[model samples]
Target: MEDPARLAALETLRAVRQRDAYANLVLPQMLRDRRITGRDAALATKLTYGSARAQGLLDAVIEACSDRPLSEVDGSALDALRLGTYQLLRTRIPSHAAVASTVDLVRAELGSGIAGFVNAVLRRVAEQDEAAWVDELAPDPDTDPVGNLAFTHAHPRWIAQAFAEALGSRGEPLKLALEADDARPAVHLVARPGEVSADELAAIVGGDVAPYSPYGVHLETGAGDPGDLEPVRERLANVQDEGSQLCALALTRASLEGTDDRWLDLCAGPGGKAALLAALVGLEGGELIAVEKAPHRAELVRKLTSGLPVTVEVTDGRETGFVEGAFDRVLVDAPCTGLGALRRRPEARWRRQPADVGQLTTLQRELLTEALRLVRPGGVVAYVVCSPHLSETVGVVADVARRTGAEQLDTRTLFPEVPDLGDGPHVQLWPHLHGTDAMFCAVLRRPV
Candidate 1:
């Protein structure tokens, strides 16, 4: 009989292939919808994300055994083979059990006859040890295409080169960045300011207090059951990365001083920052407007701030039709190539390209211009991007500043509380340096 886990894995693969949906985004909802929890859900999540992240490497492995090209293979059969190969080569599971379980799954989905094919391909792949398989996948570093297809680390050559360039002179950090992408990320949480303190929430979740910020907590373990934990359900806490919380916090800290009574979060969607901002705004007795483009995402923002004072509006950040100089402060969390949060979004490296950055820079400039237009003359506009690309970060701001008459503020002075965040024209946090997402925050002001 086919195992339920294998059925879940095959379903995840089907969804990813057909819908272009992210494994992380799709799997959780599926699991919840099916009422699968604990170990089953965890296993399904692992198989889906792991296979997606290692798709290129898995394809190479599958290609070596099959006479026909991978594209020619039936999608279901190929995915079954991938699940088998992942267990045999990458995981610590027993080889026989892995092969047997996968073959059973193939028989159930495809046919009894197809099981033989899966068994043959998986056996060949399993015969080799991990090191040998890695060598097989790894390309010759000296050659052109082979050199470009180095699979020892499983990241594309262009991405690896970009990491090296961004980390400059520090070769170890670049390697670590690649390794971090492969490793399981920690579950982080943000404490809503008045609803709960970081210390109190940390005690509830059994997490250690986050080192950098008062409102952040890094849970060492116990991410499995946020619902069971009463503190989380009370809306006093949320599952969010400390790094993201820090970026949002840094923005409020930079501009919230000297009484910017009203706040705006342009391009707020799925509302993680908006949640934190709503709490902060409530504390200050200020008004907040979270403008999101999509109806579903705007509804999500509203759901996140259900009982809170923040207002969620379904509208474009570029042309929300708000009066000029209406808000005292605005956060233009412009959408760009999400290079900074790649570690969390495992399959992102494969999906992203150099061309995407150039395209995003155009959108970033437009968003920044609109954000600045809405801010009161002396009010602050903190232009933020969850990416470190020069074009998206510096270039967008530079171009917008030239046209809008906006002046850059001392970023270092504004976020002096963040350690190693020295005084500068803008703040660019690095994955290698801060052990956080590569978020860029540039605080600019319109001349009165």
Candidate 2:
């Protein structure tokens, strides 16, 4: 029989590659189906995520080791090779054990012929330490810094360029940001206002208080499924990034001169920000309208904001049809490339392409335009995205401000506690800097 943990990881990788499934979503279900539990489950999770996150680098290494070009390798055989290479280079497993066990797994899944090929390639792979292989295979950092950083850090070159561009002057800061994208992100829980305090939730869950977000707690890895926690199960707190919590809080914290009661979450699907916003509005004796275009996601929004002063609407944010100047606050947490949260969604870097940006920025502009329309004069519109790509962050904000004649408020003042915020009427949070997702926010107000 195949080693269950390794087998589970291989199967999860296959699902991600073949079916376009999300590793984080597919791995848990695969483990449960296979009855993989305890230390074995943890091992499976690590192997799966580590292998998926390092696919680009692993493939480069495999191409170097294989007799034939990577294109000639069969899909199943390629996945097995990737799995074995990841274990050899990334894990502490001895080369002999990593090779022998991977050979066994390949034989069980893909037959002796492919197993022989997998064994030969992986043996060559095991001969080099990870850094040695990286040095041998990675593009020169001096001439091709973007490509070098991409391979070394397991991101696409475009993504590395995006981060570097966002960082401006580079060296350590750019390197640190790229490295952080590859690291596993800690789970962050938001203690919903009027439901639970961050301290109470942290105590209950044995997590530390998040450094920046008043309502957030950071859980240690392998803290088990957060859904099982009573606070989360009861809707008192839910999984949310500290950056997202801060973005929602910033909207409410920004000083405004008008009646601040009605709120609109323009793209509130999968509802994390909407739930946080709803809880805040509820405390102020206000109501929130959460608009999600997809029916399924709208249902999710409904469940997430249940018992809060929020109404979930299934309508396109670009055409929400809300009365002009009706909302005291509008949140355009627009659909973005999700470049910011790579650690949480390990497979996304490989999935998204540069072309995705053009379409998304178009949608982002539309959503921001609609948000501007909904906010009354003197009311605030928080344009937020889980990305720091200048096009998606500042570009969208700048375009909307120019077109709509909205005043860009200095967003830095709202998060006075956060350090190294850079020059910002718009706030850009980084995973390396703030231990949070690279969420971007710009506060704007229409002329009264």
Candidate 3:
């Protein structure tokens, strides 16, 4: 019989390959359909996400092993090869078992001829472990250090270049950043204010309190679906990155002169920040107006913030007709290329092209500009993105501030005791430095 776990992983890859479906989104339902749970589910999760994350490295190795070029290989056979190759190189699965399972899966699906082809490729691939393969196949470190590190860490060359550019260093700092960005981050949960403190929630959920945000808790890595946690299902907490929690909290920390109640989350979607903002604002009897362009995501905002004092508006944040100088605090958590949170969304690294930056940065600038216009004088706006790409972070903030004459605030002050922040009027938190998503935040205040 075909292993259900391997079959599930294969189908997940197939969905991703054929439909451009997100692995994270597709795999969960796939698991449910097959009633895969316990260790089998965990293995399936690991293989599916790990294979997708290491696609660059795995494909290079597979092509090296196969006699034919990858473009000529049947797509389904390639998926099986990737799964087998990931197990052989990255996981502890024994080489024979990895090869045998993959061969069996292929024979069941594509018959003997293609199965024989997959078997040959994967067996050749198993001849070298990951480090040996890296030495043989990776770029020459002496001549192309960044490219070499990118290959070792399974990141695309352009992404490594961007990180090298962002860090202002191409040596150890860049390597550490890429290493952390490549690993899976722990699941972080935000304790709903008034409902649970981070300490109380941490104890209940068997997690540790996060170092940065008081509302944040960290579950062990590979804790399975955080939605299955009782606190989350009971509405006492929500899954959010610690970096995101800090950025949203920073908006409230900015010194506002009068009326600190009215707030806005200008690009709130799938509402992680919006829910936290709404809970905090509602404490002081304030209300929040969350704007999302997409109707479906706006509906998600409403569901997540159901009882909170939040109004979900389906409108463009660049022109939310809520009147200018109205809100006391605004969060422009702008849409980005999601370069920062790559570990969480394994497929994103391969899918995002550098060309995506120009379009996203344009939207980011327009959103920040609109946020500045909407905040009352002396009111603060937190311009945020899940990416540390310079164009989306400093470039967007500096350009918008220069044009609007908005005063830039030292964002480090808002993050409080967090260290290794670099010289900053803006803050770029790195995964290596901060153990959080590589979230970037810049605070700007309108002139009174």
Candidate 4:
């Protein structure tokens, strides 16, 4: 029989390449449908994500070996080459098996002609290890330090530049940040606030409690589908990154006086933060309004927050048409370039462009502005984005603050005991530093 893992990985790559499907989203369903459990499932994940993560590096090697440009290569053949090359260079899988299996699969699907081509390219790829290939392809560090390191770490140069700029340095800090991008992040789970304690949830799932978030758990990487976990299945806990939990918790942590009943999640969809916020507000008998413009995602929010006191509204957040200054606390978890969470979404670094930033930043600014308008005077609004890009993080917050005269609180203080959160008023969490997605949060309060 054909190797199920490699076949699954190849198909997943094809889906990602052709349809812009998320590997993380597509792979799990494929594994389930194929009944690829345990070692097979793990291998499929490693192959799929590893190949996606190292696309740039592998493409460089393939183009070096190929007589034709990658654009000229058949998509299916290209997928097989990537799978074979990732195994040959990165994984411990032997070169003979990697090449033979990939060629065999290609042969079965596309005949001996394409298989011969895949075999030829991959055999050339196996001639040198990843390090040797990187050394040959990477730019000289003396003149292009960032580009050199970015290539070495298998990241797009623009992403590395964004990381350096966000850190306010292009030195060791940039190197550490880029290195963090290459590590596979463990799945993080958020224990339902009123339903399960973090300790109990950790014990139930055999995972470690997250260091920072009181209700967060870190499951072992490749520990199978977290969606199948009992707490998750039972709705006692749900998958959410610790950094995201901290950002949601920050809205609750920020001191509020007088009425604290009404809260709004201006852009809540797929509802990770909304669920947590709902659970917290439910503890206080308060209600949460989760406004999601996409109907399908809004339904997701409704489903996730079923028992919690959350009302999902399908409308553009910039014009929710709700009463102005009606909410006591608000969360503008605005969508952006998604540069911060690249470690979790391996293909994202390749997909996002610097040009995508301007459009996203404009939307982010509008969302924050709307959040400020919806928040009552003296209420706090946590402006959160799963991006460390300055234009999407502090730029939007600062610009909106200037325009609306919203008070920028020291956001660092809100995330108590979370170390290495640099200079105040805004928090940028790094994967290497925080072992969390590089989530950015800025706390703003409408002036009384």
Model 3, global lDDT: 0.93
Clashing pairs in 4: none
lDDT (0-100) at residue 345 of candidate 1?
A: 78
What tens digits encode model 3's per-residue C-alpha lDDT throughout 1-448? 7598999999999988899999999998888878889898999999999999999999999999989999999999999999999999999999999999999999998999999999999989988899999999999999999999999999999999989988998899999998998787899999999889999999999999999998999999887888888999988999999999999999988877789889999999999999999999999999999999999999999988988999999999987787889999999999999989999898889889989999999999999999999999999999999988899999999999999999999999999999999899999999999999999999999999
Candidate 2, superposed: residue stretches over 4 Å from native: none
- Which numbered prediction scores highest in lDDT against the true structure? 3
**RMSD per model, one decimal:** 2.8, 1.1, 0.8, 0.9
lDDT of 2 by residue, 1-448 (tens): 5588988898899999899999999988887788888888888888889998999999999999999999999988888888899989999988999899888988887899999999999989988999999899999989987788888999998998999989994477888998998988899999998878999999999999999899999999876667768999989999999999999888998888858889999999999999999888898899999999999999999999999999988999999778999999999899999999999998899999999999999999999998889899889999999998999999998998999999999999988689989988899999999999999999998888
Report the C-alpha displacement of residue 163, candidate 3, in angstroms.
Answer: 0.7
lDDT of 2 at 108: 82
Per-prediction TM-score to the true structure, in the order listed: 0.90, 0.98, 0.99, 0.99
Q: Which of the two candidates, 1 or 3, achieves a greater lDDT against the reference?
A: 3
Question: Could you arrange the candidates by lDDT from highest to lowest?
Answer: 3, 4, 2, 1
Candidate 2: global Cα-lDDT?
Answer: 0.90
Q: Per-residue error at 46 for model 3, in Å?
A: 0.7
> Can you tell me which runs of candidate 4 are displaced by over 4 Å?
none
**lDDT string, candidate 1, 316-426, tens digits:** 888899999898889888998887777677678778888897788888999999888898887888888887667788789899999989999877675556666634688
Local distance difference test, per candidate?
A: 0.77, 0.90, 0.93, 0.92
